[model samples]
Target: MGNSVLVFAEVKDGRVKKVALEMLSEGKKMAEKLGGDLSAVLMGSGIESLAEQLGQYGADKVYVADNEVLKDYTCDAYAKVMADLIKANEPAIVLYGATILGKDLSPRVAARVETGLASDCTDIGLDDDGKFTATRPMFAGKAYVDLSFTDSKPNMASVRPNALPVSPPDESKKAEVVKVDVNISPDDIRTTVKEVMKTAGEKPDLTEAEVIVSGGRGMKGPENFKLIEDLADVLGATVGASRAAVDAGWRTVDDQVGQTGKVVSPNLYIACGISGAIQHLAGMSTSKYIVAVNKDSEAPIFQKADYGIVDDLLKVVPVLTEEIKKLKAEG
Candidate 1:
């Protein structure tokens, strides 16, 4: 059989993660270039119904491992099953979404399968000889380097979430779903998920949101953060903060954005009063369009921002928000 490009179509809370859908597009492109089929491997209970949705993304086949043990995310159970599947049928390339689950699972699977794995890769492409070449940031996003597996039979790479644009879903496409049965005992599972406690909020998840409004120390204090929140509310963007603001106790740790915090790559990132240190820029530098507003014209954020406004954030934010609201109301 010709080598196939396999992707892990991860699902959470009964919905397919956007990163997985993004991978299908990349996987399809890679498979076409390599002259092979694209297969998506889905592991979880009661997810067989999602196989059809995978086909619209250009998956030639969908492999599912549905069992009660695989219902909740467990490192041991997922890794064991995936390793067994890989050993049984070798794929030329395996692409995983570099999400929380993928970051935790890809390295373990790579070690178990004895293959080269790259993490947080921003880009992956095929070499002239059908080999995989990837690019990933290094030194806390200060620089980037190329990665590849020259000797491994299967090349593995975990791409960052939101790194790729989503393609329109084409329901006209069709694919075959293959079910893989695996035996799992309680002893094989070392850990059990008692409960998952997520932050209660109506706002979208920061990492996955398309737009974000972030603030720094220049916001004066936590009370002034409402200005940032007001703009975010108008734009339907998530709220983020710089490490300076977080360390100063002006914002919660969950809202912090930097190399030490969550890595976000949104479509539009608005920086209000953030001085843009290298560490803070490490997190949101990959955003598509950056708009920075700060009183300091010499702030480093202006270097990377697509648009810059030198003004007092407190004076400028409310006016900008209302202008956007007015445009929306009229449009």
Candidate 2:
């Protein structure tokens, strides 16, 4: 295999996802360490324009698979293209962002290429011998394990979003673009995407949000979530909920953050009224900073929280929001 690193640059709403750029930034470092080239692949219709942005981030080469059949995400089409590309250019390391699309696409491609994949990795690097190593959470965040690929041609790992920082792009850089021919017919795809409907909200996805303000059963009723929303709005943060809040129908499942829900690692995670169950902590234990608010001073969340507030969220949240609003106004 060639000592090159390849990154799958995922795109959403005509823009490259931040995590993809982050992977490319890290991929560049890996490529330099391996004394090889850093490449990226963009797959979607009318996405050729995005290849230049990838190059600026660090991709020495950009592979474009732009076709009508590849417009929407399909397991068969994407998997086939990715597997074929890997087979054509045997890179030493392959990186994918552990987003919803990456989570689904990486496993299929790995199976097609007959390689083992480490998923939801928080860290990745090369050992002194130039072997790829990945660190991933285990046992519900209670432990972490480092994995190394053995007997695999290309080391593959799906890194979690926000796990790595994105380096600034260099506008002077340009990438050599390669367009892949779409050979698959409609018969290859079993599913059809007729229409795509998106939820109407300006808030970012829970998994990708930088700041999250979450509430639990202590919010009392669904209507009481207004407090959480108020705080989230003032802070320009996404609103999240514990499983109990979702179970009580106070928030939608998309807003739920826990073991049974979405895993998130935002910069600032403010938990209000959540008791911080192990299952919940498992999902967000990797957050950069965690602040828990609960009336019960002995809540389990305090054990894991960087800062704890022993007070009623109903009163504390509104005051906190007003204080932030005042601070913003003063600034």
lDDT of candidates 1 onward, in order:
0.90, 0.93
> Under the 3 Å rule for N, CA and C atoms, how many clashes does model 2 have?
0
On residues 1-331, what C-alpha lDDT tens digit does candidate 2 reach at each position? 9999999999899999999999999999999999999999999999999999999999999999999899999989999999999999999999999999999999999999999999999999988988899999999889999999998878999999999999999999999999999889888898899998898788879898889999998889998889999999999999999999999988999999988899998889999989999989988999989999999999999998999889999989999999999999999
| lDDT per residue as tens, model 1, 1-331 | 2478889889988889889999999888889998889998889999998989999988999989999889999999999988888888788898899888998999999999999898988888888887789999888788899977878868999998888867888999988999998678899999999998878777757777779999999999999999998999999999999988999999889988888998888889999999999999999888889999999999999999999999999999999899999999999
Which pairs clash inside model 2?
Answer: none
Residue runs of model 2 more than 4 Å from their true location after superposition: none
State, as a TM-score between 0 and 1, how close model 2 is to the true structure: 0.97
For candidate 1, what's the RMSD? 1.5
Provide the TM-score for each candidate, comma-separated.
0.96, 0.97
Q: Please tell me which predicted candidate would have the highest lDDT against the true structure.
A: 2
